[model samples]
Target: MSQADNLIQRLFSRRAGSLLPLVLLGVLTGIIASLVMMSFLFLLNATLGGLNGKNLEDFEALTWHWQLGLPLAGSLLLILLYRLTPPACQSVGLAYVLERLQFGQGRIPAANIGFQFVAALIALGSGHSVGREGPTVHLGAGIASQIGQLSGRPPSQLRLLLGCGTAAAISAAFNTPLAGVLFAMEVVLMEYSLLGFAPIIAAAITASALTNGLLGTHAILEPVSLSLASYRELPGLLLTGLWVGLLAALFQRLVLVFIRLPLTSRAVRLLLAGAITGGLALVTPQILGSGYDTINLALSDGLPWPLLLGILAAKLLATAAAIGLGVPGGQIAPTLMLGVCAGSVAGALLPGASDPALYALLGMAAMMSAVLHAPLAAIATVLELSLSAEAMLPAMVVVLGANLLCQHGFHLPSLVITQLRVRGQELQTHPLRTALAQRYLSELADMSLVEWSGEGAPPRSKATALVVKRDQHYYLLNPAQLEQRMAPDTLDALLTPERRLQRLERDMSLLDALRTLQDDTGAGFLVPVRRGRGLVTRARLVHMLTEEGGLY
Candidate 1:
């Protein structure tokens, strides 16, 4: 690490203690994230539109042969891309981002970000039934993480940047700044406080403004003002929530099936996903791209019963197959498409006159909330889209109700959590472990330091402890031992070879440190010595966790 990185790491060890710098960094991160999203959307549109003199259209206008062959061709290109990329750098998307931020310190490699940029373009541009939001979210967070990694920030500050970038991405994609902030908190951080709120909010707002100004787009969806028809519709609303919850469960279950399949080869998985998408597109072309046109059509009451029913079955299966089989794309836009279709169908069947847009809105909130277990984010999305308080009442009822069914009735975890679990990274179920994993190692570093590694008489300092380096290892010497003449005379002898310590990187968290210590219970932590840098022992981690009400 550079000296500047070390300086920033040590400076922000106490999370959120520096609000000014955090907010400033949040703005910078948001700006970068917005430019990335603008480019992503432009490139995707230009590629899809360039085929037939259409300016910015999806694959809906494509020839039958192009629609049939694009997904398969995309898979072939991805196979070539994957073969050239290293296995370690192959991981992309939100789950991959969560793994890097939550498990290790928030040091996302730049190469993965680069791969996602190209990979998402191939997956979405080639008519895979996935969304652009996922790749954009990954891109935003990855860029912020790269900044943090370069600056040498601690995990806490780095985590803040990660959240900021996520918020910016979602904000830019959907033009919902509040939803973006909540998503960063509710989905990524999995915890929240005022310390996180300011920077996240700043990032979300900045990103939303930048994208809107640059792209001349605002409120991508023509969200209508909606309210309940009557008290009699309460039953219908309840049924709608329950129905949407069932769809959410089915969506997750389909992905789960593909995930658990015996097919082990990445090549087989990608090709099979491509083949399934191609087959489904033959049945209904609506599942070809991100399906934004379908979503708009549903909200406008344009889809007929047969078409709605067709999309209900085909899009669900196509998205499940694409995502479950490990396509490096996002599921958010697809989830919205599925929700709108399900909601429109539910509205048609319910025994009351209703606006199709209202049902579509409710369905969007319910499925998104239930599947991700993120009701607040869903509600915030509804409120922002509607720009009124009317959407909140029903949004809450259906959103929370569906979440209850998906979590309690179906006993399902969030989709993102499921994505992690399938890859053998279980949620840190223990509250304390999860808490510690969010904290940094520098918080427990020893503050007192009196280096005596020189050959002279230790420079005559009044420090209480003597620390020295020998053979690139740090040894904690006793000042009392020196006073009693029991210690070795020379600095070389003062550093004994008795017990070697593990080299702990300055970026690791307390949880990471503890895990390393667990490998050899006899070993302790020894940070590389720079100017005034001190060791962090195993006992420090224990003390941080077991102290007065820290665990409880």
Candidate 2:
């Protein structure tokens, strides 16, 4: 092998050696992702400002006719874009990224990235009730995937790179570094390790610093100082969690309903969704965009209860229609808006609440936690956004309550996981199974204990297994069983179809390897190490699982 090839092999031969390279790659990924996100935000804001003469989110400032016409035109444009693009290149957003990571080895097509950029620009700028974070995530992960492909990293390491990019994107989007790391762990990667944490944290910190330096902390919700009125408000916090959990469940169900609509034509769906959003916009322009401005108003208690309720209903319906119809925007912004409205309503109705702003902040965390099924990340996001230590206790209580209600009461999973299931990609959520899936087969392969030779006399040692090489194939044999059965002269006679061996790449996961074993009646699998092919037996796997605290 060439020296360069040898070095590449050494770097990624095991998971540990890949960490430094991943960390270095993560720095580059963060910078690139942050820059791309900044450019997208700038272009989107410029386009919206040029059209409406206000901030990108200030769709309410536009005239009634403009508010009604913008979404209709934008939706038609989206339909045209989809019609022009190939179906394979049309998938975008968090669900797409997760699907790719799970099955595509973190390889995102460049065409999809281009499509997402253009589609998101049209959807967000034209006053569609969606956030830009989803597109940003696609962009970041796509860039990282391209980098991994260029570097020729194995799929195992490439997945880590994808997580780094995802973290960077979230950090850049909100300038919440710690929240970004937690989100990547809880939502994107779905598994965590010290090795993975280092790179992801590096990526998030770098991305947050870079974006803050360039854009000066591009947070949508304005910071507010908040505190609980008293211990008496604890019950109110619990009720708020229950209320927001119900709202979150409703929102997720509505989005799923929209996603599973019977209409086969993409154009018809887009048009119908646009018409709904536009009709709603005519009634309440505050629902026309991401609704960040309205969220701010609700947070500061600037809007009355009636207006808050109206904005909440309109925004919820519009966002659900837009996303369900497959608009290329994010659900985060809409969820935040929903939380604000829910909390505002709670504060007005509940007597023990100290301030509406406090409830709004807690409700925001709770709704996000319940809908995304990411309590720690949601709590971190709220603490970072508010910069208030005093809000942590209330935030934790509300987030826990909301999560419990969603999981037990409604039997809801995270929105992304739900969408993935709808698309026929059921992810493994068991802790042991997920942990095993993250580990490579090479990690468990026992090379020193096995002897490799032809199908002849046994090796002069206490070897547990024997590998017989014939022609270009390798077969595994149990020494004790071989002694009981008597010597077989030819390899072909000994290795029957059921005893035939399967070849496993060094990067294939242990869980996947186990699954392969269950599906096929092979003697065992052969894993290629630097020295030679390593044999992994079913007995070995069972032992490992037992040691790891039983099968999942």
Candidate 3:
């Protein structure tokens, strides 16, 4: 078939594929993920509750034997699971999303997910100070990919739906819909467009609805009503946010340090982490199971400074050790513990503070923002959890401050650092080469080969090319073109003087590039080498931009 016919067929096929079906699929994926995660969480909580041999709200003590055995046995199970799984599958959820989006749809190996689920259960049930959200995120996305592959969807769309499932998992886990949607868009997809938004939003909403239905309709954070003594206390909460940001940065750094440790045996590292968590649990049982109860106590003024500080230190070490040991788990809940402790201490120290619960809530946002380097997601989480406009302003201030500090000071994002470590990538001051490569050629090189008309000699009118915008107004090649031809020793041989050159800015979006191509005739025209740099012949230019040619 002719090129014209091929182009027409492809375009028509894309146009005919309805968006509604994808949206519905997203919703379905979200609902299913929500149900699955909720059921898992329920079972975990019920099992843990049964093991506790007492109520959840009360400060009940377990026998020394039980205390030591729970985390130890759980840790052993996690270590065994880690030992069995491959190194590439060690990175749990966020890494999976990033890889699938930037790379392509590939199975995460069924065994990996099974091991993760089992390990997460052991971690949470034994009180390893980890969250269930991370495992569920992997579970949702993995399941969605499997479904898509079975149903024969395109790899690209299937990966997109996988992101939708990830969003659903997070939303259901936290019961915070907006945060889940933003997380999927900002961190997972890394692109904000109408194409992705519809599916992601549908997924997030469906997840939230299903979770609320099962779990009895409660906000995620669920903070107590604080009776404000005075307006003067507001500044202290803001100050608390600053401290929380620093703590978040510290936590991120610690995780990076542990992950970077040169341990030859992954099994040994995991066993060591197991020992650490098991030992810590014996002293302070509160550090186990995501430490949600401990977080509540800290926020509610149940513990003094010394005890809170000890719990903070123990939890930090336990969490970092567990994740770095290569066991599958989420950092989100651990971060919540860090923030709660930080904010609680700040609230305790301040003079005549209105309410520390307010500060503790703000601290969560700040800490998470710093760790994730995603202020928008953190802020959305704060709003969804708090359900208060008054809370939004304070959350925004701390989250922004925390994110800025993390970017400037820490120099490592939590999830990305973990991913890089698992992949054995060197941590350097510069960005990854793959990320840099995407921007260089992909923005400009599209259908560039068709423009190459290998005629013996160019016609007079066609020889001196004309570059035009929409409606066909000619653009000039600037003096650089002339200089290249005049200089004998220069790289002028690489120049395509026979073709018209058009100026393209470095920051032009892909959509804009596509629109420009639609208006131009023949093969695609050349884009400028840089901002304000004029274009060259499409044939040589395309070759230069790509890896196939030596120029790259």
Candidate 4:
């Protein structure tokens, strides 16, 4: 290896638990993730600049014929691309990232990233009613995963870097570092710890700083001050939460319906996805693209209730079909629009609220929280974008209400989870597994051990494990068991089915080890360590999680 490569590998191995290496890794990840995200944003803007200057998402400027043709052309192109591309590379999105993290040990192919770049650019620039955030997630996580794989990091650390990239992407996209961190934890990692927070926070800050420096200063959503008038508005806020939850559930259901449809032909699905988006754009041009313009209008009171309602319905259908069928764009932007429209309509129906804008903001939070099932991240996003500390209580109320209704009332999980489950990929984020994943199994392995000849047993078992080699593989046993295994015809029975542990070539995170541990309940995993083979047992893992709360 090159000198720097060797140095990095050495640092990674030596200080795997240190914060300094992680902080530096986070910064580097942020820089690359932000630069890549900006590249996509720049291309998207330049591509769409002809249709709408300064405002990238304004499909209203397009004539009806252009609006009708753009999405269809884009869809045709995507269909062609999908047909030619390998099936493994076609899966791209935040849900894909989650799936890889849980099942694939954070390994993402580079081809998928390339596919996402092209697909998302075409889908978003062509006014497909999808957002950029979903594409951003795919790009960011894919890039980070590739980097970790190249660096020769283990599964656990690779997972950490992947999350760092995800956080950086969001921070760069929105200039909301806190929201990015929260989103990474709540939606991406689905766990929180000091080990994760430090690097992720650093990555988010770096990403936000770089994007702000390069893209020039502008708000994704303008900061609007809002205040609650009286106790009377509380009921309406709760009702708005319920309304947004219903809308969120409907959006998910519509997407699922399109997904489950019997349109087996890829060409037909892509064609209809594009045709539906274009047809919606024909009547309500504002529904095209991410619909940021529509959101701004709702926040500014520019859209009348009837027009807003029409736009909302059209946008919902367009987004569900576009994203559900095959488009590679994001869901967050469209979700925000849905929330804003739903909130605005609710505000108009129920007077005595402070302003429709406040409701708009609340709707954004509630819809996001409910749809993504990320209440904390959604609340953080709105708070950071709006810069209204006073909105916290109401945002929380609406977010929690929406989440409860969407999850319990409708029996739905997060959209990403639902998608993966449909594809037979279960994202196991059990609290115990999550906790175990954070720890290095090698560190907890019994490293101090003695090797025993097949003929005899060791002297003692005090703070030292006993290992025996048979069939060129090492297995762990105590002195007494070693003696028992030396008897005639006893080795095969003991080694094969009774107390044999699987051997690992190197140290792995407890999460990966635990996954491999499910096959046999006899013993744990064995890894080659410095002195001798290090043994990691499943019982030890459970004990660590339940009893060693204060130890780490």
CA RMSD of each candidate after superposition: 4.1, 4.6, 10.1, 3.9
- C-alpha TM-score for every candidate: 0.88, 0.86, 0.72, 0.88
Cα lDDT tens digits for candidate 4, 459-531: 5666556666677756666655456325646755555544566777766767677666676655777776555
Tell me which residue pairs clash in candidate 3: 127-288, 127-289
**lDDT of candidate model 2 versus the reference:** 0.81
Q: lDDT by residue for model 3 over 88-128, one digit each (tens)?
A: 66656556555554444334555556666676777777766
Q: Compose the digit string of candidate 2's lDDT tens values, residues 502-548.
A: 77654477778778877887776777755676766777777866774
Badly placed stretches (over 4 Å) of model 2 are 1-18, 438-489, 496-499, 503-509, 519-521, 526-552
lDDT of 1 by residue, 1-552 (tens): 778777766654434367877887788888999998888877877888775356243566777788788899999899999999998788999888888777766778899999999999999888888988778778989988987776656677888789999999889877999999998988788878777898889999999999888877757676666677776877888888999999999999999999999998888999999999988888798898888777777776567867887998999999999999988899887888888888888878887766767778788889889888778888887677656567677777778778888999989998888989988997664666877787776655665657665444554556655666566766666665564333344545645544345556564667777787767653356554334465665666677577764321
Query: In candidate 2, what residue range of length 10 has the lowest lDDT sum?
Result: 483-492
- Compared with the true structure, all predictions reach lDDT values of 0.79, 0.81, 0.63, 0.81
Candidate 3 segments exceeding 4 Å error: 1-18, 53-60, 83-91, 105-109, 151-156, 218-223, 226-235, 425-552
**Candidate 3 to truth, TM:** 0.72
The runs of at least 3 residues in candidate 1 whose Cα sits more than 4 Å from the true structure, single-residue gaps closed, are 1-16, 52-58, 386-389, 429-431, 450-464, 467-481, 487-508, 512-524, 528-533, 537-552
Error of 4 at 133 (Å): 0.9
Candidate 2 TM-score versus the reference = 0.86
